[model samples]
Target: MSLYNPNRVNPQRPKRIALVIANPATSSSTGWPVGFWWSEVTHPYYVLTEAGYEVTFFSPDGGACVADALSDPNDASGYSRHDLISQGFLHTPELLARIANTTPVQDLVSADYDALLVAGGQAPMFNFANAHALQQQFAAFHAAGKVVAALCHGVALLAFTQTTTGEYLASGKTITGFSNQEEDQADQAAWHYGWLPSGQSIMPWRIETRLQEIGANFVHAGAWQSYAVRDGNLITGQQNFSGEATARLMIEALGR
Candidate 1:
């Protein structure tokens, strides 16, 4: 018989991870209150939890997360219709509660977990950039040789985060995020993103552009394909499709 039990719940194993999210914020381009992406959160959450790691949701503002309507798997636009993983998460009362009430990111100390995963959404463009506490957390986790995973726009956190040596976190890191071509593809689509007063893209700066500017070796595959890269313990996923890929890498890194 195998010593491991897939159905066993190890309550005291001390294997915990934090999923960080952005509080609701206005999308500069669309003017909508944007929060976490459904697939970016649910897909990775599914993979991590099924692997038996205790996951906790954290937010800078500490409250309920509002889904980007376009990312809702059941949304009428059908943009994310194939996202049955998220569809199932939406239906789980207990799982749904985790996203509905997030613990404040500030309340978490470095000793609280083994790793951290940042979730993507339009809100990150508004808030995750240059947040001191978050940057510190990134540094702390990486310094501890623990996994630091970020997906989609959430990867933007590394663009401005720094090491104690005062270098940008992306300085020598190989990372990926929402790519430029993909953004251009979205721009040309029929989706109704809010127009800026200047009639330009609502996001003042692009995630890929900022990452490159800060010296990260950004990489990507096809326009909408799932792509994730692992550099040391730093893991980054390109977009929604990359979430589970990133999570799997983290599972290996955690040795779980």
Candidate 2:
């Protein structure tokens, strides 16, 4: 005889999310310091935590992570002065500590979280595309039928990740990332601010172009628009402004 009662009800476990950020690195293109975008990390974190999801931070090489200079609200460029969310996160001791030292990406397991979000900034344009370990972890999450998400330049990983079957992970998927128009605008801004030599691009590669090259059905909204797309379990954001939209899509995918 079975010991279980048919009338018994069990409580559901809270959803767990793993947020992967890039460690600080100097941009090969601009020689500028780069890391995760402020809004890309804080906005989604704010939304996910508000939904009661448990979120953890991780990095490809582990240890402390930094935010891009322009993404910082206090940056002299004043590019992100209106980002109160990022400003609050930078001031909160507890939150600030979370990014100080992150778990290594190699330590992650597909079974440990319900979803994975790769946050982005200028650093990811250099760091994430060729990180084999990070790519494997991201592929593992997808293979396990979990929600997989990437925002802005973080989506560059999708262009290089392969499925267990050795096929491009983004093949035939409808996705969106930092678009060419946005990249052009960013490049222009960099030159205008003397951050880069005249007529030079700020990033080594363009996320949208890469995804398209990998056979993804790349899509996007207007430049700098808050836009995200969901194609089955894959969720992608257009740029920094789409962080919250991407997180909400992940929640939707997880049925939370």
Which residue pairs of candidate 1 clash?
A: 29-202, 30-194
* Clashing pairs for predicted structure model 2, backbone only: none
Minimal lDDT window, size 10, model 1: 190-199
lDDT of 1 by residue, 123-188 (tens): 888888646688788888998898999999998788778898899978878989999988877665
**What's the TM-score of each model vs. the native?**
0.91, 0.93
Clashes of each: 2, 0
CA lDDT of each prediction against the hidden true structure: 0.84, 0.88
Give candidate 2 misplaced runs (Cα > 4 Å).
Answer: 1-12
Which regions of candidate 1 fall more than 4 Å away from where they truly are?
A: 1-11, 190-199
lDDT of 1 at 149: 91
